[model samples]
Target: METDSDVELAVRPAPHPWLVLREHAHLVPMISLGGALGALGRWGLAQAMPHPAGAWAWATLWTNLGGAFLLGLLMSCVLTVWAHTRYVRPLLGVGVLGGFTTFSTAELDTRGLVAAGHPGEALAYVATSVALGLVAIMLGLGLGSALLRRGRPRRVTP
Candidate 1:
């Protein structure tokens, strides 16, 4: 027999490595779509935003940061609200946005930071991103949970 806490521990879900890989299975389509949208959005921004000479790279930086921040916010909403349903989290988070962003590019940026003699900045950037990203997701989950719980009408005896 298990106590409530024991049962909670027993049922605790740890993220699966294979789940990440498997998520890639569906990510192909999600990325295909999200990337197309991101590309168009980037193009529009380039045309719309003013830029300095010899700065083609600025658009990319803007796009990636914008994407990450938007992803953090959108992911929070999806994870919290729609997350009440089965398969929602994986499809959106693991599939769509996961495919949208590039970890490979992030790694490259980290390497560039080191090469640029900013190893400390690189380390701090990585740490801050990881920590903040986690916190954002957690906050989003908590908000959605509260909304869902609160939306349910409480039963009271007259």
Candidate 2:
């Protein structure tokens, strides 16, 4: 299996501006679908497990972080197991999951917290989320890196 640097080198040899957009196009509907599902799931979660303080803020945080973890897992699987197709990466990963979770909501939540005279808590929430989100991604990536090693295509009989 290639090292992280090698994995990147293998894939990053070419550059394409339009390619990014194209990838997004593939992922748009998937992202939209993920968003719909995620929103509904969030609503259910919120109802089932209401936050102690800020309902919206907590819910949004939960959703985004959850989505990020899911994304990490998905990307790892697709890259390692499903063998990402041209359409899958952009549409499913980029569009659906990216759309499903949000940074904008997090920003809005922080803004609300500040406006409501809880700057300290707001900052704390932001900090905690950022730290946790990154950690979650790292965990996902670590798991994925292992999958990458394991999923290296096996030899086929001629």
Candidate 3:
């Protein structure tokens, strides 16, 4: 025999397609606006800071590291203190940070460094970027989580 839980599940109506779309309708605009601004900032940085010959692309490296850190912090804040806010995660984490970080440009920079007779620099850049990016994320995560915990209400046990 079906239990009450089973009966309740069976009687519940599935959400309509229109309702699903409406639920996520805000994502498009939020992501779009954040992405546009993020991309524009990246482009402006690239233009303003030209890469030196036979060396690392400091701009891209900085961008990726900063973006990764921001994403980690954003996620921590959203999942903890700002959990009640719906759109902050999508707009900042997915839209802005996603657009700000450029894997394609990073790869191109590495390749160009190698092609420009700087294989050592290319390897160093790649290694440093990956290593530092990981560290940035970890640092951001730790700091954000600490701040979140500090701001939260603590329970007093008897």
Model 1, poorest ten-residue lDDT window? Answer: 52-61
Q: How many clashing pairs does model 1 include?
A: 0
For all candidates in order, the CA lDDT equals 0.58, 0.72, 0.86
List clashing residue pairs in candidate 2: 26-91, 27-90, 27-91, 30-96, 31-95, 31-96
Q: On TM-score, who's better, 2 or 3?
A: 3
Q: Candidate 1 has which clashing residue pairs, if any?
A: none
Off by over 4 Å in 3: 1-25, 153-158
lDDT of 1 by residue, 59-139 (tens): 434445555665665655665556566455455554455544554555566666777777886687567556665665566
Candidate 1: TM-score?
A: 0.52
Candidate 3: residue 132 lDDT (0-100):
90
Ranking by lDDT: 3, 2, 1
Q: Estimate each model's TM-score.
A: 0.52, 0.64, 0.77
